[model samples]
Structure formats: C-alpha cells, structure tokens
Target: MNRRTIQGKYEIFLQKYNEGVKKYIPIYRVKKSIHTWYNAR
Candidate 1:
C-alpha cells in the first residue's frame, strides 16, 4: 500500500511535469518564430 501510494504520487508528478513541458514548448516555439517573422517582414 505504501509503495502504491508513492507510485500514485509519482504519476501525478509526471503528469504535471509533462504539462509544464507542453506549456513551455509552445511558448518557446512562438518565440523562435518571432525572429523569422521579422526577417520575413
């Protein structure tokens, strides 16, 4: 039971970790596009 609880918490932490990565990835992608946009203009 203790191990299961730890696993559950770890899973939750991984979910948050993935969510953070997902959120940051799009922002970073947009930032990268800013340079190209100015060049194109």
Candidate 2:
C-alpha cells in the first residue's frame, strides 16, 4: 500500500532471486562440464 512496504517487498524479492541464482549456477556449471566431456568423448 505504501512506498516503504513496496520497497521492503522488493528487497525480499531480490534476496530470494539472488538465492535462487546462487543455487542455479552450480547446477548449470555441472551440466556444462558434462556437456563438454560428452562432446570431447
């Protein structure tokens, strides 16, 4: 309803988004490594 509340929600959303990205990057790296290995073979 207010600017302060909206800002708070945005902060929370950013934190969750960053957390999700952190979780995703490792899996992405692993997949990339596997793909590279498969191609090499």
The digit string of per-residue lDDT tens for model 1 on 1-41 reads 36668889899889999999988876533444456547645
Indicate the TM-score of model 2: 0.50
Clash list (residue pairs), candidate 1: none
TM-score of each: 0.50, 0.50
User: RMSD (Cα, Å) of candidate 1?
Assistant: 6.8
* Model 2: lDDT to the true structure: 0.75
Instruction: Tally clashing residue pairs in candidate 1.
Output: 0
In order, the Cα lDDT scores of the candidates are 0.75, 0.75
Instruction: At residue 30, give the lDDT of candidate 1.
Output: 41
* Deviating ranges (above 4 Å) for candidate 2: 1-4, 27-41
Model 1 alpha-carbon drift over 4 Å, by segment: 1-4, 26-41
How many residue pairs clash per model?
A: 0, 0
